[model samples]
Target: MKSPRVLLCVRQNTLRWDGEPSSLCCSSCCVLRCFDDRAAAARVNQHAHGRGTRTSLVRHGDPRVRLIAAHRSPLTALFSARGLQQITRQQQSPATQRRMRQQVSSEPQGVAEDILHLSAWLARQPHLPPVDDLLLDRFLYNCKYSLSRCKSVLDMYYTVRTAVPEFFKHRDATEDSIRRSCEVTLAAALPRLTPAGHRVFVHRLLDADSRRFDLLAHSRRVFMLVDVLLHTEPVLGAVVVLDLHASTWAHVLRAPPPLLRRLAVCFQDSCPIAIKEIHFVNAPGFIRKFLDIIRPLLKKKLNERVHVHTGGLETVGKSLPLHMLPKEYGGEEKSLKELSDAWQLALERRRDWFKAEELKRVDESLRPGAAPERAQLFGVEGSFQRLAVD
Candidate 1:
């Protein structure tokens, strides 16, 4: 009697439906109900048929010859124990445990490599000041915080650790050591503010094999560095201003608004970067929240004694909108030239606006809801205009 022909069907990118058999196989006694590929039969016959070619083949089913679906294929299960067992007899032996350990040991170091790569890229920037090792440490500490809070980050940290050198064992080194390494790398590198340069560097760092570990760390560090340098480096001030104008900080502060506000003023009077331009794009709503917290502080006139050494356009642009003040305060908006002219007129009158009753009243106005808001109304408006125009 002639035996029934058998065929095995394979799925391509199709989802395996529930209760539907994901695989097909043929046996000597049973026929496949719905397989697609008959082409495989020739190969199977050539490979497995042992009976005389002339004789009728029996349709007995062989459990070993079952068809495995793509999802269940040995290749698909490459990471499974059965697949790994086929690698080498040595791997099958006790050596497998050691191999696993070796893999585990290198991940943290790999993470370190990614951190170093990012630091190196940032160091190459022309507009940024030379970052010190301590700064890098701060960056790494931020990474650690991210890892502690996010599982995905922890996975990246481990993957990087696995690629590290033998001497840099994760078990042997503490978080502080890695942090120090980060700081050292940053300290050794210089900052560059060219948009083209920064974008290129950012791309490279993110392309790293296990990039996520240091993502938040890098973003926060770069933004903070830029923010600080804006208040300090006069030469790079214009570029930072341009960036603030073109970009927003929305990308970095994915967390709550309160936290974002705290970060904005966390440096406190330590305006390391020149304050020519401030943008809210990177962290949308960040600047407004910052202003809210700072309004009361400004009303206190704490910065009154502080000499804000603003130069260039900022110095020339220091004018408050009069309308921004309440009607009772005799406030009116004035142009840059007008503000400058007003200041000059005040000088001619020998009336120091800084010491005038208006200034004192504004200072005293810092006490209650109505008056306090006015003290800030002037500076906040000024800061916003400067940031916006920059």
Candidate 2:
């Protein structure tokens, strides 16, 4: 049996060489022919660099090199350690450049420019809501930064807002009745974004009193807050964490299927923001039954994203980061009380804007296409069965 032959490369006096027989004179680097003789290897090293090359570490100012066993007849020069380092440096530049380009492309200035262009386009259209930069940007964002989709969503948003007067009409966030309903903390959008850049919204029934639950007022507040978010921030998507702990049968009975249907249509169809996930934590068995009633009405994609976490917060934590959640949910963030108070304060500040929004209705007669029929517009029908309470 023949011993494996080792090819050697040496860098002496700042000149590098590899063990290739074809080229004796080192132009760039040379590879020494594979030899099994230890004495021959030592002799070759002494002649090449006045020292043995067996040690992995070379002195400072010495060329970085390595030796590899070449069993095949043809000696191939394996890249030296320095050569590998150079190749790595070369490879990293493109990735760094790509990352820089991504950073520049994601700047808000570009988004602002797009919104300006959209605002100009909206200025020419009739019977539309006032096309301010903020509103236009929200439309642009909701449509996933597409101009055409933004226009469509803007049209549909107003059309639906016009049609659903019960929810949109008289939307005074400062009113005692509206404030009281919102105070229940059925849901509240967090002040921070998730690691994946999604806007986190937590929903849980704080009050068991069915009479004070006012589903319409809660829906209005939710939409109002959503509108505020759209106008205030450049949100990419939403993550809803629904905690159904402490919810009673009374709360289940108050779940109006028709209102749920309308809300589903509004978010799934009319609204521009993409609901990335709807996670139900501490979900009761009855919640699943309630979901079955509304599941048919929800978009298939959305229904698929709905996760029921009955096991507890650990189950919810698998999808949602613990840092993004409130302290009550075994997280590091502020308590739900603090979050809800901040949100309520934000809603209070936007009271006048909500009133203005409530009055800004789309005139169907002035619309370019055929007016949408009331029945098709609202999605309200007498066919929805009342939710049965056990």
Candidate 3:
């Protein structure tokens, strides 16, 4: 590689061209040499003046110029290294410029390694919330010392702190409050969390919060967001690290027909539009029955021109009203079974077994995907058997 350029100045009369001091060129003051041969004198002059090239060191009235002394030959030299230093001192602030030069020289060499070490440090921190008030304390300390690291750590602190509640699902909280928590925590913890530790700690904290809200209810919009998150989870673990439960998707799909249909309509206009496919995967068995019950109503709305398309029929699980089952049967105790059973027995005398397909969507594929899956039924035969045992 080419060396970096630096201007050099030789002091006057330093004609040590052959590594020896000559009478024509002394340690100080101008000197000259004369040759008996004119051609030799010209060659000597050219060599002394560096082949007629105007070196940057050349300046008007510089001591290196040959004085009109009868020394028989022209001599030349420029300022020395110490002289160059003196000149630089005149042009720069001693303390400030030196410091700036030092910084410029060191930054380029340190930058890449700094980034690597910083990232590694952030990765090692435990991902737990400050059980006390330590987060803001550490951040303030970092801001005072490691300013750049502080900014990065603060940004992460805010993002994870804010996203925590949203992903975990709890009672309603404002985005502003979440944002504030991040700011406060970062102010305390920036000094404490190394970059690697910061990243890992944030993740662990989020994981803990995620576990706390193991059972989360999604709003219609958030239900749609779940699909988007799931799609991008593989390549980058950040999206997937929150440990999303399969049941969360199931809950979204099992929303009532009206809610699920509304979400589907909203999803149609969202970016990528592919999130709609996630709804099918999240569908639950109860939602299937719910759709069966609402399909005729949706068809009637379509026939009357009150709605454009009968959309909810595709989500059969939404129709199941499984929430009506008591807590003993894995439901929210919504009592839909009691009401439906009462209605069924009320029309018992005029029972119709005709709507087999309509009443139960027992497709062959649904019978058992891998093993023999049993469908728990509350039909008359099952009820009669229970009554006899009682």
Who wins the TM-score comparison?
A: 2
Per-model lDDT: 0.26, 0.59, 0.25
Against the true structure, candidate 2 reaches a TM-score of: 0.67
Q: What are the per-residue Cα lDDT tens digits for candidate 1 across 22-137? A: 23331111122112234323333442343223222323253223222211111212112222212111101224334323322323234335445555654543322344332333
Using lDDT as the yardstick, the better of models 2 and 3 is: 2
What TM-score would you give candidate 1 relative to the actual structure?
A: 0.18
Could you report the Cα RMSD, in angstroms, for every candidate shown? 29.7, 21.6, 34.3
Question: What is the total number of backbone clashes in candidate 2?
Answer: 8
Task: Please tell me which predicted candidate would have the highest lDDT against the true structure.
Answer: 2
TM-score of each: 0.18, 0.67, 0.16
Angstrom error at residue 132, model 1: 16
Model 3 spans > 4 angstroms off: 1-217, 220-256, 270-272, 279-287, 291-390
Candidate 2 C-alpha error for residue 168, in Å:
1.6
Lowest summed lDDT across 10 adjacent residues in model 3 is found at 234-243
